[model samples]
Target chain A: AQSVTQLDSQVPVFEEAPVELRCNYSSSVSVYLFWYVQYPNQGLQLLLKYLSGSTLVKGINGFEAEFNKSQTSFHLRKPSVHISDTAEYFCAVSVLLRRFGAGTRLTVKP
Target chain B: DVKVTQSSRYLVKRTGEKVFLECVQDMDHENMFWYRQDPGLGLRLIYFSYDVKMKEKGDIPEGYSVSREKKERFSLILESASTNQTSMYLCASSFFFGAIPGSGPEAFFGQGTRLTVV
Candidate 1:
């Protein structure tokens, strides 16, 4: 079985600051990685996905993630964040089924 | 756009009562899943159905059951609702790719149903 570990449970960042949410997975075989964001009282939306291609995957809202095979990590990063970026971020590893991390609550202060 | 809709946004049921959480997807996805969300437990899969009438137990499937009579609809049934089951329930759907389910793409999630079992 595969599992995901999100190093941070909560991250607080000031507005317009850069942020990186770490995600690591344990899988013997190749895996697909994804990032999803859930706003307050809303369902989750796809932030980005790494299926097959370049290691650097850019997603909506100026967010990006790098799939480092050697490190077994797919960390989400954003050059700058805004107040609207405050939400719960989930990192998922897809093998036969998708397993998510505990979740990281990103708080963007004004 | 793909849309996964849960029947209820909020539901409250008494203990020991049989609870049914409905999910419907309009994208004609071949796979549907039921998951429970807790404060620290991101999302634990309860059950998932790959095709009509085929169900698979997920990580946490102790007190949960699922029914999928149709491709777009999947229902999660709580045989006996308990206070411990009071959590946000989410429904998701994904397209079935090649023979390997792992090839399937990212899942689309519903708004989630806040179930309060008291």
Candidate 2:
């Protein structure tokens, strides 16, 4: 079985400021990592994924995440955020099945 | 673009009523999943199907059942609707792992149905 942990429950940032949402996972076998974003009243959309090879993965909306095998972490980051970027972010791990973290609510303020 | 569609954006039902939530994917994927989302709980999987007529119970399947008689469509059933079951229901589909050779395991999600049980 695989599981994900998102350290922060909520994060608030001013417009154009940088932010990072931390995530970690536990699994006995190798697994794929993913980040998903959900806008208000909408379903989740894939932000990015890390299958193999590269440890750094870039996603939509100027977001990127780094896969650290040693640390068992996949942290999402963005150099700058817009007000429209306010949403809920989830980190997930998948072997044959995928398990999602609790979620990090990003609130971008003016 | 991949499209996953849910039958309703919002629904209201009385307690003890049987409820059905329908989901369809146009991508012809081999994997489909049903999940419920709530504040602080993220997304908890109810069920998933890897093939036509095949189903698997996920982490939280106690209050729900599922049906997948055909490809591209999966249905989640609440045998007896209750206030505790009121939440956002999401449907997702993806190509089976390595099914498309080089495709990744990324699932496409629907618009979600917000079901309120009274």
Candidate 3:
């Protein structure tokens, strides 16, 4: 079974500031990684995915994540954030079944 | 646009009553999942189906049962609702016909149903 761990439970940042949300996973074999975001009162949307090749994967809303094999990490980063970026973010790992992290709540303050 | 739709946005049910939550997908996905979401726990998979009438237990499937009569429809049932079971329920679908277990396909999620047991 595969599992994900989101290091941070909550993150606060000022608008236009850079931020990073840390994630790590445990698996014996190769796995796929993903980041998803959910706004208040809405469903989750895919932010980005790391299937294979190119450690750096980019997604919508100016979000990107780096897949580090040795470290077992897939951390999400944004050079600059907007108020709209405030949402709950999740990291997931898949082997045969996909498992999600505890989730990180990002609050972008104006 | 591709979509996953849940039957309800919000629901209120009495404890010990049977509850049913429905979901439908139009993207012709081969996999459907039921998840329970709590504030700090993120999403915990309750059950999943890879095909019609094919179901698998997930991480947290102790209190739930599922049915998938048709390819596009998946339903989650709570035999006896409890206070602890009151939480946001999510449905998702993904395409996994020819792909490896964890290699291909991304899941699309429904808007979610907030079920409260009183």
Give the fraction of native contacts in model 3: 0.69
Residues A1-110 of candidate 2: C-alpha lDDT, one tens digit per residue: 78899999999999999999999999988889999999999999999999999999999989999999999999999999999999999998988678899999999999
- Each model's lDDT: 0.93, 0.92, 0.92
**lDDT top scorer:** 1
- Interface RMSD of structure candidate 3 (Å): 2.2
Model 2 TM-score, all chains together: 0.96
What class would a CAPRI assessor give candidate 3's docking?
A: medium
DockQ of candidate 2 is 0.55
* Residue pairs that clash (backbone atoms under 3 angstroms), model 3: none
Q: Which ten residues in a row have the lowest lDDT in candidate 2 chain A?
A: A91-100
Ranking 1 against 3 by TM-score, winner: 1
> Per-prediction TM-score, chain A only?
0.98, 0.98, 0.98
For candidate 1, write residues B62-104 as lDDT tens digits. 9999999998899999999999999999999999976864247
lDDT of 2 at B21: 98
Give the candidate order by descending TM-score: 1, 3, 2
Query: Taking the tens digit of each residue's C-alpha lDDT, what string does model 3 give over B90-111?
Result: 9999988455431335889999
Taking the tens digit of each residue's C-alpha lDDT, what string does model 2 give over B1-118? 9999999999999999999999999999988999999999989988988889888888899989999999989999999999999999999998887643212478899999999999
Index of the highest-TM-score prediction: 1
